[model samples]
Target: MTKKMTWNEMSPSQQTGVLVTGSIQLALAATAWIDLAKRPAERVNGPKALWAAIIGINFVGPIAWFIWGRRR
Candidate 1:
């Protein structure tokens, strides 16, 4: 089995890739949450509360929200 690497054990490029990917995920989630907050109940395809929770998931959640959550 492969061993897990800690943050300190990762190389600079690997670290940078992780950071960048994490930043993108956070941004997408934040944008989805913000849209949910500002949008009306009727404007959203599903329950806002459900979307709120789903937004916490990684890239998939936010992308799903953007693609299928909104009425538009």
Candidate 2:
């Protein structure tokens, strides 16, 4: 299900709000990487390897939500 979305219809504040939220969440998501790294400690896998997994979750979910939410 979807609704039509028009960028022209959104106020500047709406766009700004999305951007601000995205950036703040992005920063916080880095912590998820830190959390992931800790899990691998004392194991063979490197802590930094978790960075990829963390970034994947961090970026994908919100992007999907924002894009779909705009349509509605």
Ten-residue stretch with the least lDDT total in model 2:
63-72
Question: Can you write out model 1's per-residue Cα lDDT over 1-72, one digit (the tens) per residue?
Answer: 999999999999999999999999999999999999999999999799999998898899999999999997
User: Which RMSD does model 1 reach against the true structure?
Assistant: 0.7
**Model 2: residues with Cα > 4 Å off, grouped in runs:** 1-4, 34-72
> Which run of 10 residues does model 1 get worst, by summed lDDT?
52-61
User: What TM-score should be assigned to candidate 2?
Assistant: 0.42
The numbered model that scores best in TM-score is 1
Model 2 per-residue lDDT tens digits across residues 1-72: 887657777789988887898887886556544444454445323334544443566666334333331222
Off by over 4 Å in 1: none
lDDT of 1: 0.94
TM-scores for candidates 1 onward, in order: 0.95, 0.42
Every candidate's lDDT: 0.94, 0.53
